[model samples]
Target: MSQVRVQPTADAIRAGARAIRRRNVEIVNAAGLGHIGGDLSAADILATLYLGVLNVDPDQPDDPERDRYIQSKGHASGVLYTTLAAAGFIPDSLLDTYMADGSPLNGHPDRNKVPGVETNTGPLGHGLPVAVGTAIAAKLDASPRRTYVLCGDGELQEGSNWEAIMAAGHRGLDNLVAIIDRNGLQQGARTEATNALDPLDAKFAAFGWAVRTVDGHDIDELLATFRAAPFERGRPSCVIAHTRKGRGVSFIEDRVEWHHKVPSAEQTAQAIEELSE
Candidate 1:
């Protein structure tokens, strides 16, 4: 413990999430590079996990029994770094070096440098497979600790994820929970036009996962849905969190161009103000 501890309720998680968004805008504005849209969309989910749900303790990051979290949508690292800072895994000051030449805060997370990250993740479709392995290890050890992975809707196009999905389902990795930040837009266009994943829930169900759909931005709903995991016994869980890219900021919300765009000084201020409320 650096300072942060798991918050007791959904309201506390929501408040921390707002702070995360405010700091995330600043982090991107200062660093001059970031996947702002996806970062904003996943802020609530990350915050809820780091601050309210995951069994990770900042001081005991490598505790064998601690829950594992992998950011499969690794491009949105600004939010991940900010959430880690808020969770006390890293000092808030370390965030100032994000994306800098010698910084550990790279464009994507590296477990070697980051205390809470379970593994290196940047390439799409790789994390869930790694998470499936971790969950399998836990099963072998008979540990109660869970494995969670957050993925991007766009990356679902990769065949590797499907393979991992099939393996987890077939092995009955009920300890695994995969959350897709289903914000619709991906990079320059919408996921539907690019590679439709609309029947995502049915796909997961068919893959043998207990599926649940929730408003990704609704903190209370997300918290409740996550807590009620593995909707069925002996099955993996898939949470399709429908969200808008650039969720909290009015001008940036759902704008595809903002996917990797840096906010101007004025826009950053406006975003911070909006998040403050």
Candidate 2:
């Protein structure tokens, strides 16, 4: 069967992202914990994938032929959970159980517990390797299924990711795509302060991957980029998505401390207000 690309309208994509952001704030406020900075920064990317790009069935999430998505920057589980609910993978009510005792929703994603999750991932640099293997398997079977991994820019400093980059490039795994959430800030400081990832596009290019840098929050650009994955016929694809931490909330925007900070009631209300517009 020929692939029919998914292309949701830009307005629809923006609405989806708004809902994800609103719900992410709600979940964090309820649980009194979350990585809101990264969650907000990557919310649009997550929304784009779940609402349009991914070939996933909410009712049949485990289908072998489904395209795969691994959230490499797993600290932002709130956005992942909110996106999953928005995509109908889980009941929206399940979001209430997040960070609660015995709840399947942990601070990091657990595929064994989440129906739509492709693999358990939290540690930085792990998802790409797993994605590489999955993409290799798809190639071996001659399946057209694709695999995507979203990693934080700071996470790129981990050595394991380069290893996967090398392997994917060397193997010509064109079925895979890696997106970096380039929000600039990490947990304790700016990514540049801790470890610079400048020249990131060139580095990926050096590894033999086709690279593109895009406005991560732009729904239209995100949809276009995802659809154009495997930019080169025999090479993997990499998208460096420049984003801002705490994107929808004016006060917290680009603030490093918001990485795991729970929003206060007033702050939550303000954030929801901005997102509503």
Question: CA shift at 99, candidate 1, in angstroms?
Answer: 0.5
Evaluate model 2: give its lDDT.
0.91
What's the CA RMSD for each of the models?
Answer: 1.8, 1.7
TM for candidate 2 is 0.97
Prediction 1 TM-score vs. true = 0.97
TM-score for each prediction?
0.97, 0.97
* Superposed Cα deviation of residue 135, candidate 2 (Å): 0.5
Compose the digit string of candidate 1's lDDT tens values, residues 135-229: 99999999999999999999899999999999999999999999999999987899999989878999998989999999998888888888898
Residue-level lDDT tens digits of model 2 in 27-52: 99999988999999999999998887
